[model samples]
Target: MTSKPAIGIFLSIALAASALWFWQTQTVRPAPAVSFKTIKGNSLELASLKGRPVIVSFWATDCPGCIEEIPHLISLHQQYKSSGLAIIAVSMYYDPPNHVLAIADSKQLPYEVALDPSGTLAQAFGNVQLTPTTFLIDKSGHIILQKVGVFELSDMQQRIEQL
Candidate 1:
């Protein structure tokens, strides 16, 4: 049989861990104001990107679904940038500033990315359950589209053009 002290210690540890997870999960976070800095120190503000339609992709490095959709996102970012579209990839995992930059560099991605390793920003946008959740915002900053499953970037572009 276990000693009483041992059982108490185990319970304490479990409760502490549970509380930490709860705190992390339950807290609310609001969307940031127009701009915020990327982990790498580049100035990033939603307001500065206002003239263009915005695409915010919530992804994680290790998620297969997220990785699979990256090329599509890249295509969207490239094709629409000139048309006043801005794509901001908000990574959910392995989100050090350097990690975000490395992916951008390797892919030769021209748009911007911001990290939210702890899900603060993700929560702000009401995107918490899955990776690769994408939001397409109109130039006026309204969330015009949202995709939770795998989707084609071209299809999104076609829809935007129609808007």
Candidate 2:
């Protein structure tokens, strides 16, 4: 009957939708193995930070969104640093080291701020071409979230806590 055929089609659509949702939710990538040299003259190897949640943010000093997210990033570092959460804010290659250092000092940022003058850091992180791009890697070194522009603080906090 027509009613039976309609019901079958609806079930098929529902099943396909569920499959797509499952696939999307499970798509997580491993973080790239990269090293960072912070403005404070410290070296950090991404592989060494395994078993800890890490936030690798690519930003520029001139980006308004990046500037706007600074406070939130600072808050997160303060809240979670004691709990094995590491945050590295890498300035874009085009941003001069002096400018990055000036901004970091002016803001009194408590976390690591690195300069990417050669763009190797950006290239390691998916060839990052945009400012205010952030990747949240879990304790297992798998990137669970990649967001461009400003991210929701609550959502990021929740994810970090979950990790």
Candidate 3:
């Protein structure tokens, strides 16, 4: 008769093997271009944002993570703008234009924020459910990173530095 220990070992080995297989097959991915109108009431082009690293940060007014990271994003903008880092703060829910302006001002966020007036663009890009999701597009406009939730300021800077 087999002992329970043998079964446990077999299960553990199987789990490990499957986990490894899954890890090798799947990873974070970038998105193809999706369209949206600009808050300025003009045609904002996604193509224009290519050939550099663009951070499309998805947020809603009520998300604490969204609110907390504005300052970090502001720093990222200031630090990396001249170095080809483009940050587009995309709102997942519509707030009044004036309110957005005020929050941006208070946070000292000088980056370009295109309001997703209906939050549809968030779905169009990727991961519609996650607030404060940051998509990092590489020099060729292919997505290289999609970070859900708040991330360290230094980590963002480090990645940009490498780029």
* Best model per lDDT: 2
Q: Give the TM-score of candidate 3.
A: 0.75
Task: Give the Å shift of residue 33 in candidate 3.
Answer: 1.9
Runs in model 3 deviating more than 4 A are: 1-30, 94-98
118 Cα displacement, candidate 3 (Å):
2.6
Evaluate residue 114 in candidate 3 and report its C-alpha lDDT on the 0 to 100 scale: 76
Clashes of 2: 0
Candidate 2: where are CA atoms >4 Å away? 1-27
Question: Model 3 scores what on Cα lDDT?
Answer: 0.74
Candidate 3 residues 1-163, lDDT tens each? 4779899999999999887555423324555566645555556666777778888888777789999898889888888899888888887665676777677667767777778776678767754677888877778776766677896788778877867
Q: Across residues 42-119, which tens digit of lDDT does each residue of candidate 1 receive?
A: 878786666577777787666688779888877877777678777787887455667667777887766677777666
lDDT of each: 0.70, 0.90, 0.74
All candidates: CA RMSD (Å)? 9.9, 5.4, 4.7
Ranked by TM-score, the better of candidates 1 and 3 is: 3
